[model samples]
Target chain A: MVKGLLDWIDERFKIRDLWNDFADRPIPGGSSWFYVLGASLIFIFSLQMVTGILLAMYYAPTPDHAYASVKFIEEVAPFGSFVRGLHHWGASFMMVLVGLHMVRVFVFGAYKKPREIIWVLGVGLIAIVGGFAFTGYLLPWDQKAYWATVVGTNVAGTVPVVGGVLLRIVRGGTELGAFSLSRFFAIHTYILPWSLALLAGLHVFLLERAGAGGIWNAADRVPYKAEPLFPNQLFKDTVFIGMVFIALASMAVLFPAPLEPQADPTDSTYNPRPEWYFYFVFQMLKIFEGKLELLGTVILPNLGVAALLLIPFIDRSPERDPAKRKLMMAAGALFVATVIGLTIAGARAPIVNAPAVTSPSVLAGRAIYARNGCSACHGIFGKGGKIGPELTHVAARRPDAAWHLKHFRNPQAIVPGSIMPKLDLSDRELQELTDYMLSLK
Target chain B: MSDQDVSRRNFMIRTIIGIGAFIGAAISVPLAGFGILPVLRKKEPDWTDAGTAGDLMTDEPQERRFFQTVKNGWQEERVERTVWLVKKADGGITAFSPNCPHLGCGYRWFSQERQFKCPCHASLFAIDGKVISGPAPRALDTLSAKIESGKVLVKFEIFQVGTTKKAAA
Candidate 1:
């Protein structure tokens, strides 16, 4: 019965033939466990897409609700925590797999001839995935996400002429808020995924067209022997994927993803650090501070990406053996080593302390005041526009918390004709600001 | 010899299948339960102390803050919560949740104006917690409170923030 149904479909769709063409393609003799990296990357990418979609169903993309929504998913949703853990670990896994695959391609000189386009597509995929990671990091609206984004956007603002514009565009305003969250959610969920899916499809198509570039059989001075892809290579890839799944599941069950404190834009004591993958770049900023910031933030990184993309054009050698490609091998190795070294150094670096202040609520209140744009009119500690009365000693002058609260809710209610705009704050936020004002005395 | 060997082979095959099924169930059942249990769980509210009745002045609203441990699915965190305590002239004590009656933004006490003001949408409440003006659809949501040996104990509950009526969350 199944055979009859399959035959009926195959008559119009050529399903069997399509399967044969895709699964039964020829693989080279030198293919080994090392060849599984690319397939593993594809597998991990699909996992990320599935888990990310599941998460998006519950994720709220507004500054006011983002943190609470993520908390809901982590604590209240069924298996939501596990699914989140999978997505988190899967991102790191994809990075590792893509890196390993790129290293394998470069070392084998697979990017040598008719395969230049594939290499270019692969580089583009890396950038897109990196972008996916960066944008997704802020969706939870936690302390880490907020502070890291602040530092990241500030780095963009250091670019020579268009720095200020780039910073505004990335942040969606002068600071991170509702607009920034929505913008990141759109890019992370919609834009980058579609772009990555298209680029990945092209990459696979070009890869199949060129065939696997086997390790050079030195004695014959030619490529290794060819083998069918079906049972041999595919079987090995399946095993590798299963092993990766087991590892991922175990990690998800054990550690799970962390939910840090809610993002506080007003808190200044937070020490912002980028994810492990971007630690090398973060470390570069430290080494090249002040006048040399542009060199680390813009010039060097772009040059590295350009060099990676143009490798096929630069090295036109026919040799596929690493021994024959001395300069390329050395440069690739050095680049990998430096990145690893810098990442380790960044991780080991001591945390730099900001000026310590007692009372977190007071600090939070100060942040709320700034976020609500109160400083635009009122002067505090002698800095700000003097249009409104200085708030430095308002607590002592009034000594009534209720009056301040009523005035904040309705400026005209307390002051009769007060023009101070009503500032909307949550119950917790109101108390925070009240506490801060009371402390001003 | 042939009969004996056939029986032995059948026994071995059955044992392998039995073990495989056991392991599969061991891994899958708990995982499935973990994925489904959160949907069935109910949230319980906690009662907390706001402050002593003596700490509040007559006809004045005082702000009190405390931390409540919140447990959701797999996460447990201590979240800061706040309330407004009013010591009425009649010697009766009343506690109000800080959320404004209109859009859920916090309403503050304006001592000079002797009223509660919500900055977000200009919602106003009197010192005794009645809606005075602006977009509020009702009076401030008051929590259940009791005085025990000079300490004011209040049953803290969350209500739907933007609702016209006070609905427990």
Candidate 2:
């Protein structure tokens, strides 16, 4: 009777006993640092989702109430500011981690052999992040969101024949009105997040199946060994998340987000620039717009994406060691260097002031503003929206022609952290818009 | 080559195979659960119409209520909401939400701006619900309205909106 009872207890406890076991895969020291990047990215993404849901609990998407709701979250909700801060910092964290993850993948040759799909997924991830940045920029519904979106849409119009259609689709019409915002909000808050979650799951599952590439594969001499994954490696993941949280907390404390004044649609001389990540591409496009504008703006980026996906195919050799793969090393370095240079160029690009113009140009300017969807971001009178600024008095604010030109040339210089992308405008358009903006009393 | 050694080798092979099976089964247990999630998830959204045809008066914004019974896997939920149906001067109809675009607050028709306005954040919309001022991210959604026997009908849904283009409606 005693033996039978003991056997029954053991049978019932079998599965519970099984899960308590763990395994380890030998993760190298260099990989240890690199591992933190992916883990940190996941941590931040999870945090963003959680906080976003909390915000959504109280968020209203209507233009009339979005700002007040945001303000209410910041002021009245319990720990609301903290939650918002987490989301804000989390986005920045995602950007940084993605870059680092890309670098790590490149250097380690992790994207090679049986991993082209993984690399392509990484590119897809960036595209989603870009979408995220674009959509989130408008959430504050302040000057930065409004003007930046205007410049962004205008730039989209520069893509040639299909450009007009693409611009219209992106803006949800010729003007940046209700449709555009709705489309963007749907894409940002609902669509992209679900896709990302699905893809991420796939990516992780594939990585696990492929197993850790192991430090020895890169070391040439030391053969790879499987190490227990739990206490040995996963513990470090826990620690990494903790560190990331602390860093995010520090950033939150140091720099609380700012709320810009309302966007003024009548402010034709608006300044707009994208976030730092896109600055390099923006700068590259400006130089190339002189020659192969479409190639530089669209085709080239698409090619880069293709190349990233094809890395595993091109890198047929099994040499995981960066030291052994000279060609890949040089290529990776060049790519990184080029992007960095372009970023610097984008940062250093000069802002030109708008040329001085007279009366008719000013009237033409108003027409341009009305037609171009500038109202979506910039406010008209003291009324309207607040993505850019109230342009009803912009002329009094910055009366100089040169100042207007500079504002149009590079918005980020005057207002740092603005999401307003620079536009490819004709000199005539720029001057007229400036004149009109300055004419606003 | 010895008889005892041959037996030992055979016994050792079987023991190893049994242990390997145990580990494989152990790993598959978690994967099985993961695999089941997509199947168990809520049903994907379908195109749904919100309200009736002529019930929406032209030149005025009317709040029409909609109800839907959605089947998500084995469970079902009956959802209801009030969405805006606007009939313009051109005799065209656009359906949208009475919910504010900013934080989802209810919006009212402001005769002054000739628009729908959210009082919470001072958001003002044009007569057509185009955002004239305030923090709304998008124009009010056009609810799919249908008329049956001159009565207006609306379909409401419990939807998840995030970074993608999916709507649960």
Candidate 3:
């Protein structure tokens, strides 16, 4: 049996040669913390696949009882919570690492010239990974994913020209409905993986062919010796991996992800935000709202990336020494400054969920909630079961009664395509519900 | 001019044109590949079992997680997956992903609304993943699911998440 298995394996993948090639090569820059982010992404992806598979074993993708099933994964499946934890934290880390890798390449001018194709591939990878984060974000079907998807897609549809068509394709129809999950899941697990793997293989292949190139090496003229990728760099790689794992594990342990309320489509105050890496971009777009949505979201960033991609071709100073690359240094500094500014803007954006915490008007809100039979589809103050996002945080999150009133009266008016129906309410009823809702918090 | 001078000039021109064509072809392949990959990988609409029909209960969603070991390309190993077996109030059955369509957030069926709503943004859908309201782009995706032996199974392909089928804009 052992001999037969060995023969079968050899006849099939013939992976020995691939492994040998990897073993033989010495990577540019050998083993360094800087080089670890890309590899960490691969590690996280693998970890995500495994954990996702495990979670899926017990997960139900149906909007009905979706959260209940996830709760089962947390409570029943063997190491199910742990597995979900791994997948969750791993995803967050991958986004961070991917972002860092981009910045590293930018600063090092690794995308310059002969490596332009790689840079293009890198950009494509980043976008795909963001999609990965987005799709994966909804896998839990909790409050955050539900509200975020709605807000996120609304923003997506604002894109010009083919935006509507693109929106339809993504939702698998007109709204974020059934086909959307199917489409995203298929994309996430099937399409995205294959694309990423192909890109990853190609990226590494080119890396091997061209080696790592940058201004640091130009002064050396002579290609310096690098440690064999096997033991030397591998050990360092292992150390970095260990550090990442510990950090991720700590996060997973300290705060297992919180499941927000079941989605209700009717509720306003769906304050959503992207993962941290996206926070800066999200923040940039927020600032651009009502002013330069197009330039901020589409044109400006694309131009920045374009410049980054063209760095290798431009600034072709004959010198390779880092000390001599003053213009290149200045350009890098400018880009970093820009990104930092956007991130700061994002971090400081008006807190959409703060004011509600200060006010309490549960009596008025509860009256309306009861009158509307919101309890039928939603659980409130831990009274109802899983049907929609618990309104426990509604007041805490959306404090302004007037804003909430405007949002509640006809959410679709304020938020186009909102699932919430416009409630026919007198000003008194609105204020009463708002007060009651506020009191619950 | 001598033969050497003429030959050298022709050689350089040809080399440049050859390089340009190669670059153009290289770019085109990836662009075309991106467009065609979806069509190429679409699954044939065929019946695949999700699990033992007996395991599914009536009027409530039963979470079924299943796995299979198959050989595809170079890898062969057991892969796990999940789906919900929703027995409708009228005893009808459907299997769907908990993932909501509104921005890919997971959604739960609200027995109260007799609809599905996203907890993240309040997007509502009917029992079957239809967009009942709130920022949803489409309805729930239905899996080609059924029951076979006393076992749960899915037409499983362990694909990488976070790639493919991009959102608009």
The lDDT for every candidate, in the order shown, is 0.80, 0.68, 0.65
Summarize candidate 3's per-residue lDDT along A1-441 as a digit string, tens digits.
Answer: 998998799879888787777765765544455676777777677767656665655566667656777776665444445556767777778877887888777666677566777877887887778778887776667777776776566555557887667667666766656676667667777788788888877887887777666335634545664545655555555557666776876776677766777766655456676666667778776666543777766777778778765666675554445466777777777877877787777766775764442344444556667888877766653345456556755665666778878876788787777666677888778877777666544
lDDT of 1 by residue, A1-441 (tens): 998998898899997887787766776653378788888888788878877877776678998878988888788676778888888888878878888999999998889789999999999999998998889889899998998888887778778889778888999987899899999999999999999999999999988888777666523645545655654566566667767877886787797887789998666567788788889988998888546868999999999999999999999978888898899899999999988999998888788664423378878888898888889898764446779987865775777878777777778878887788887877788878887787664
Better of 1 and 2 by TM-score: 1
Question: Which segments of candidate 3 are over 4 A away from where they belong?
Answer: A1-18, A27-31, A218-224, A315-320, A353-441, B1-169
Judged by DockQ cut-offs, is candidate 2 incorrect, acceptable, medium or high? Answer: incorrect
Judge the docking of candidate 1 as incorrect, acceptable, medium or high: incorrect
Q: Rank the candidates by lDDT, best first.
A: 1, 2, 3
Selected candidate, larger lDDT, 1 vs 3:
1
Q: Write the per-residue lDDT of candidate 2 for residues A329-388, one digit (tens) a residue.
A: 898898888888998888777754434333578789878887777887887532346688
Name the top DockQ candidate. Answer: 1
Candidate 2, residues B37-91: lDDT per residue as tens digits?
Answer: 4244554444455655665677777776666677532235666666777776776
- Evaluated at residue A383, the lDDT of candidate 3 is 46
What are the DockQ scores of the candidates, in order?
0.07, 0.02, 0.01
By DockQ, highest first, what's the ranking?
1, 2, 3
